[model samples]
Target chain A: AQTVTQSQPEMSVQEAETVTLSCTYDTSESDYYLFWYKQPPSRQMILVIRQEAYKQQNATENRFSVNFQKAAKSFSLKISDSQLGDAAMYFCAYQKGATSGTYKYIFGTGTRLKVLA
Target chain B: GAGVSQSPRYKVAKRGQDVALRCDPISGHVSLFWYQQALGQGPEFLTYFQNEAQLDKSGLPSDRFFAERPEGSVSTLKIQRTQQEDSAVYLCASSRRVDQPQHFGDGTRLSIL
Candidate 1:
């Protein structure tokens, strides 16, 4: 079984500052995918970013980027220029493709992020 | 649909009652997923469907929980004899293919009283 862990339960950042949410996972499969999902107060799950294990380059989407260290089993999310809208529960997820037998995302406990004015 | 759609955003049920949550995936999507989100916790995978075939349901907490995607589009999760522990947000997501990113719906919040 694969497990994802988000050590930080809560985090806060000043407006326009940067914040990083840490995550780690335990997986024996070499072929897998990592993701960051944001759930706002609306309770809508939104995709923040993703990283393929085979890719050495980190993934970045505007203010959101990921530091994926496959060897260390670390996949942390970095949010730059944080705004009030960025306040949400962030989760790290791991998934093995169909080739690995089945598909289901294993998620971390989540880290509540607050953007202070 | 514009994205995954889950009907009956909020549902309140008495203990021992049964409840059904519906999910409509995006058109042409081949993969659908179900998750449960408890308060102050991240969403946990419950089941997965590849079109009409349910490939993985190991994440389902118990035998009382059942999910099906008969036509390869819309899916439903049924909980029998709901309990207070069953109170949580049921989220549905869909992906274009096996390797694609899964888009999610607002989720159905179930409250068992």
Candidate 2:
């Protein structure tokens, strides 16, 4: 069984500042994928960033980036230049590799981000 | 629609009543998924479908819950004799392929009174 853990239940960041949301997972499979998703009040989940377990280089999407440590099983999202719009619920997810024959996502409890102006 | 679309943004059903939620995936998406999210909790996988074939339904809570995607593009999740415990937001997602990133819909909030 794969389980994702988001340690921070809530976080606050001043506008234009940077913030990091921590995430860790436990999975026996060596090949897998990690993801960070944001859900605003509208209730639609938007993909923020993604990282492949085999890729040593972290994944970065514009202002968002991830610190993916395969050995420690830690994948954290760092939001640079945080704005008010960045306030939302962030969730970390895990998925098995393509050859694993399954496409289910295991999600963490989520961390509520509050961007202060 | 350009993205996955779920119908009846909100639903209120009395206990013991039956309810159905609809999900329309992307035009050419080959894989669809259904998830249940309780208040203040992360979404949990409920079922998965490849084309019109339901490949995995292990996450469904009970026999009262049923889903079908006969035509492959449109899917529906039906709950019979709804209970208070079943109240939650039902989300739908789709991807170009099983290995692709999933695009999620706004979700349908179901409430059982």
Fraction of native Cα-Cα interface contacts (under 8 Å, chains A and B) also present in model 1 = 0.87
Per-residue lDDT over A1-117 for candidate 1, one digit per residue giving the tens place of the 0 to 100 score = 899999999999999999999999998999999999998999888999989899999999999999998899999999999999999999899999658877788889999999999
Chain A TM-score for each candidate, in the given order?
0.98, 0.99
Give the Cα error of residue B32 in candidate 2, in Å.
Answer: 0.3
Q: Give model 1's TM-score versus the native structure.
A: 0.98
Q: Which candidate should be chosen as best, given DockQ against the real structure? A: 2
What TM-score does candidate 2 reach?
Answer: 0.99
Docking class of 2: high
Minimal lDDT window, size 10, model 2 chain B: B93-102
Q: How big is the positional error of residue B47 in model 2, measured in Å on the Cα after superposition? A: 0.3
How much is the lDDT of residue B79 in candidate 2? 99
* Error of model 1, residue A39, in angstroms: 0.5
Tens-digit per-residue lDDT, A23-115, candidate 2: 999999998999999999999999999898999999999999999888899999999999999999999999999899889999999999999
